[model samples]
Target: MDIDHLTEITANELTAAQYFHGHKCPAMPQGLRAGHLAMDFLSVKRARGGSELQAIVEIGDHHFSGCFADGVQYATGCTFGKGNITKRGLGKFALTLIDPAAGRAVRVTAKYERMKMCLEMPFFEQRRQGIPPYALDPAVVDPLIDDVVNRQWRDMFEVQTFNHYPVEPARESFEAVECAECKEMVVLPYARELEEQRYCAVCYQARVFRGQASGI
Candidate 1:
């Protein structure tokens, strides 16, 4: 379906997205638009499982951008649980959704002007004043969310399509081992060796630290 029709279909998805997101904010819906546009441009559906789609987001572990990633996660279905979301720690509002099977990708970035306008709003003014987003009045927040969700696609993002973008398929791990020390299951690739025994990363590090402290 075209992006517009798809967006119209998303009327119900927004409620679910908001529920998963734990409080309403504009950034998440802003990300919703971005992810929707990327998939629409690439002609791909919301990824189902096992890396059918990968969303590489430039937003990082920050105060402002975390919600944006949540939006992208909800919209693209490229989630941490699915292990399809990759964070670049770039601290910018950008998303690159890659369909490696098709050798295609599209990058979407929030427009600077729109971002600037959001920053100047009373909602953010309260944000900068140390009020949590959920604490603000819906009256103060709903208008921004409505505007972002209803805004024209072209006005919201700068989108670029990549006919061919290099993407390596992520390998899945089914093999697991129990750490000799922690007795906890760990994926094979993450198991560390200590004295010919399998160990999880945490237990392995603890052993290493003990050895160093005792001059082993």
Candidate 2:
């Protein structure tokens, strides 16, 4: 496939994404294509950090074997660390890219036929049988990867344009509070307030679990 026409991302970026993701599976490339398409359509630069762009992904917990969200993150720069990418868990291979300042947005989704074709591949059969992509024979896996990489972008996804997608304001400030149980300072956004006391996520979950176990 002509990688140049696929997206604006460089060869190095793709390679780095693969390296970080630890595989050359199709889902990552698919995500890369989606991200690039979104940015291109919105006429926006990749988010370096902060809330320059936001990606709302529709990938579910275990629907696809590949880490599709990772692909979107790599291509769009809307990473979890930066707090820009969110999973809607609609159980569909789709995402919405939003440009808050421009008031523009678009939803890109894998075409049903294309998704069916992918699922019908021999590689997907292996996945359905509980075989990991890396565990499969390279001979079988390489061809699948090649097909995904080489396929025309027009053949893969349908883009639905929208004006005025609700873009929430970026949280620029946070209150620091002490976790009552741990007595450690935590960002308010990351802390849970219960019964007039704040607890970190870890501590909150532990407390909830302990309460449940003891019939509290």
Candidate 3:
């Protein structure tokens, strides 16, 4: 659908997400809905910062061709910038929401049938045939968008609850170490010590690559 059509019909959060994501596709709204449902089920507010909630998303690199991550980020506020969202790369359409303070969590998964329906739709066929969603006929794309935006949660996903799930509280202290080569400070959880010298992962990899190259 055109920009004006999308703005008129889609929910405000999703409309903002489409603007941030730079395209209108079904997978993004699916992720947004999943995030919203997870938040509701967990009885938690949308995370304002890192400590309040954590989201483990299972969308792999080769999933449906769209920015599903952005949708989840927008809906849940568990963004990479906030250090609250992580990717599992399991090629599954699922996410686990954790509230560390309450020790409660839920795993929300898009039902296989729902995914199959999306795969069988004309939208997917057009995408497979090298037609972008915006380039396809609006009649073809608009209905898919509407379905994603309006579908009921029970109709789209399977949400499994885990009461008393153990969630560790956010770390409050870390030993800061200086990377010997880069001379940059590295945080404890991510700093690696090699040959008695601390290095960030990036610098360590670069040092290893250089060492191997020098030997060759």
Candidate 4:
């Protein structure tokens, strides 16, 4: 991430970074979509302190975002736990993932890019030791994490012109996301025309929401 020793980025290099920033990651699978993961972390040295912060992830389509607790740098993927990306004195952004094909980039903003820079180096270092696919948990969360990052990168190009970066939700809160009748979380089919229904067949409301029951 830190390229200080490596040849400095020139205006042309910056432009190239911006181009890649906009064009990466191809389309994902039907069940999988793209987005960003924002993790909030805290800073220690800032003078006006109660809970200081480092960076926040902000990438993906729909601006899908999340924020983790500050100083939980490991949680968010920021190498420099709670310092500003540019100033290091001013804490403003977090690392991001860039994917152009989907026309999006996770962590496509300045802050997120910095976060990517800081964290990526350390992550690779760890990889050198043993960690693979970039410190991602090999089993469960990896796919979710990977898809989100790719989609976010693609989305960046589709939405805005920009520089390098890597690039949540509240509801439309679906009260029904978790079903009361069946006590199970509902799953929505891939298409917009499809319906939202519980995964379980016996659930009372599933058929109704799926438009297979009722007056019709």
Q: Quick one: best TM-score, which candidate?
A: 1
The residue-by-residue lDDT of candidate 1 on 1-216, one tens digit each, is 455555542668888999999988899888888888888888889999967899999976756746999889999999998899989998899999998899999999999998888899999899889999889999999998899888888887998889889988899999999999979999999999988999999999999999999999
lDDT of 4 by residue, 35-138 (tens): 12222111112222212222333323321121221211332223332232212322333343222222233332333453354344433345446643323444
Q: What residue runs in model 2 are displaced by over 4 Å at the alpha carbon? A: 1-10, 189-216
Clashing residue pairs for model 2: none
Q: Which regions of candidate 4 deviate over 4 angstroms?
A: 1-55, 60-72, 75-180, 184-207, 210-216
Distance from true location, Cα of 170 in model 3, Å? 2.7
Writing each residue's lDDT as its tens digit, candidate 2 over 110-216 gives 89998888888887888889988778887877776666666776788898888978889888656888899989989878899777778999899999899899999
For each of the candidates, the C-alpha root-mean-square deviation to the true structure, in angstroms, is 1.8, 4.0, 6.0, 17.1
The candidate that achieves the highest lDDT relative to the unseen native structure: 1
Q: What is the C-alpha lDDT of each candidate?
A: 0.88, 0.82, 0.81, 0.30
TM-score between model 3 and native: 0.82
Against the hidden reference, what TM-scores do the models get?
0.93, 0.83, 0.82, 0.20
Instruction: Please tell me which model should have the higher lDDT, number 1 or number 2.
Output: 1
Q: What lDDT tens digits, residue by residue, belong to model 3 across residues 1-216?
A: 121121222477777898888778888887787787788777688899889999998888955733666777888899998889999988888889998888899898889988898899898998899886668887887788789878766778898889899876676445888888888988888898778888999999998899899994
Clashes of each: 0, 0, 0, 46
- Model 1: lDDT to the true structure: 0.88
RMSD of 1: 1.8
Candidate 1: which pairs clash? none
